[model samples]
Target: AQTVTQSQPEMSVQEAETVTLSCTYDTSENNYYLFWYKQPPSRQMILVIRQEAYKQQNATENRFSVNFQKAAKSFSLKISDSQLGDTAMYFCSEAGYRNSGNTPLVFGKGTRLSVIA
Candidate 1:
């Protein structure tokens, strides 16, 4: 069994500031995957970043990045130069068993991020 946990229930960041959300997971499979998804007001889940357990370097997007510590099973998301549009619910997820290519994500409750202008 695998479970994802987001310690922060909500967070706020002023425009152009930086914010980081905490996340952790428990899993027995070595080939599992971790992800951060953003849910906007439109109710769509957008992939923010992803880290493969096999990779030592964390994954990064344009303004979004992750601090994935495989040893401690921690995967956190960092939003640099946050904007108002970044206000949304962020969810951490984990999936996969072994050698499988794709699987459905098991997500945490979420962290509602509010970006004030």
Candidate 2:
């Protein structure tokens, strides 16, 4: 079984500043995927970035980067040059491959981020 945990329930950052959201997971499966998702007021789950458990390097997408510590089972998201548009609910997820198909993602209680101007 796998579970994702986001320690911060909410956070606020000034515009153009940087913010890091911490996420940790527990899983018995060796092969799995870690993900960060951002949900805006529109209620859409957007994929911020993804990290494979086997990968040694971290994953980055534009201003969004992940600090993936495989041994520690930690995958934290760093939002650089944060913008007001970045304000949203961020969720950390874990999904393990199954013999039948891909397992449903186990999501953490989202951390609400507010990029204040």
Candidate 3:
């Protein structure tokens, strides 16, 4: 059984500050991908960052990055220079066995983040 967990239900950060969201997962499979997605008020899910289990270097995109600790099966998202636009519900997911084509993404409950001025 594989499961993703976001211990933090909600978080707040001041504008221009940095915030880190934690996520942990349980999986026996060695090959998989971890992801962080952001859903705004509109409910459109946006990819924040992705980390391949095989990759030792963490993945980063602009102001978003992931701290992927494979051994501990933990993947965390870090948002830098936080802006009001970043206020959204962030979900952590795990996709396994890409070749199978039936591997559904198992997602965490999600963490709602607010940016305070």
Full-model lDDT for every candidate: 0.91, 0.95, 0.93
- Candidates arranged by lDDT, highest first: 2, 3, 1
Instruction: Give the CA lDDT, 0 to 100, for residue 95 in model 3.
Output: 83
9-67: candidate 2 lDDT, tens digit per residue: 99999999999999999998768999999999999999999999898999999999999
| Model 2 misplacement above 4 A | none
TM-score of each: 0.94, 0.96, 0.96
Task: Note the residue pairs that clash in candidate 2.
Answer: none
- Looking at model 3, which ten-residue stretch has the lowest summed lDDT? 95-104
Candidate 1, residues 2-113, lDDT tens digits: the string is 8899999999999999999999999877688899999999999998888888999988899999999988989989999999899999999999864546667899999999
Better of 2 and 3 by TM-score: 2
- Top-scoring candidate (lDDT): 2
lDDT of 3 by residue, 4-106 (tens): 9999999999999999999999986668889999999999999888888999999999999999998898999999999999999999999887566747789
What value does the lDDT take at residue 104 in candidate 2?
A: 87
For lDDT, candidate 1 versus 2, the one ahead is 2
Give RMSD to native, each candidate. Answer: 1.3, 0.9, 1.0
How well does candidate 2 match the true structure, expressed as C-alpha RMSD?
A: 0.9
